[model samples]
Target: MKIFEAMAGLMTDLTAIGKDQKNVQQGFKYRGIDQVYNALHPLLAKHKIFTTPEVLDKTREERTNAKGTVLAFVTMRIKYTFWTDDGSSVSCTVEGEGMDSGDKASNKAMAIAHKYALLQTFCIPTEDMDDPDAQVHEIAPRAKPRVSDQQVEQLRKALTVAGMDEAQWCASVKIPSLESLPEEKFGGAMDYIKKAALAA
Candidate 1:
């Protein structure tokens, strides 16, 4: 009962936290952990609410980026317990992930987990903040496999039988050479050659 009363009091006093920090690389605004702590610390003390964190699980791995830079990736599941003076408390568990080129990956992960736990537990209002769910990430398309050497030879023979110039056909297809033609287009190219041969 005391824990609920303290939570409700904190929630009433904690108004919307503005997006005070900008991610320069990604061009979005966010509320940093420091902002959350600065806003919550005094109010938490006022309400006689204190919290402790326990790391329930942790994992770390090393990965190489496209530029061959090695990075450490860490993920942690943390449980935070909010306690009042009379042994009244509530717990929240959350998972956080971080990646860095140095040794601070785990620290970053823990901070993220702690921040989320506090925000969610208190149901803090963050109006007009850029939500991660609203962001879109673009992935590069995979390169298509080119035709094999044998397929190139077959196309050349078909071109000869059809009385079509290799250069003209390549120009029409906008490819540098038959060898560069994608495997998926090989059947269509062969069908065109067969039609030309029949017409010739």
Candidate 2:
């Protein structure tokens, strides 16, 4: 049989896998890789379908978490090819990332890539699909450099030439003072002031 026929047979027999594994630390439930393997292996064998994995790219780094704990983070891009006995095949590439405090980061990354490859290739069904919006991350806001004293003086002169109130102009840009304007916004502010001066 061709790869498409074999895949159709497998999909017909495959059932929706539930999210049985729980992340106690994070309080989330997900379908484990083992669960996917258990559900697909028999159907795949019955349909004479097989798969092979190739690592396209991989990167590793050491990162410190919010708690100051050091961890090994690994990201891997993998390609999986599904084939039938008749030699017809299909392929897919996926990227996975994993972080671990110990030596298993790479292994975890590979498993994640494999899991997604299978899940997406076969169109596997899950009772409760994972949603990115379900989680929230607290990120510290970066402080932007404000305008220099010289730039603030330039802005004040421009404001005067434009016949605009300093406090009102600052309030329009949501800054307490001319010096409080972010450096990146200075150019736009100058452009606006120039336009106002021309209109005046």
lDDT, each prediction: 0.92, 0.92
List per-candidate RMSD values in Å: 6.0, 6.5
Alpha carbon RMSD to native, model 2? 6.5
Per-residue alpha-carbon lDDT of candidate 1 for residues 1-200, written as tens digits (9 for 90 to 100)? 69989988988898888887999979988889999999999999999999999999999999999999999999999999999877899999999999999989999999999999988888787778566899999989999999999999999999999999999999998999898999999999999999989999
- Residue 29 local lDDT, model 1: 89
Q: Model 1, residue 85: what's the lDDT?
A: 79
Best of the candidates, TM-score: 2
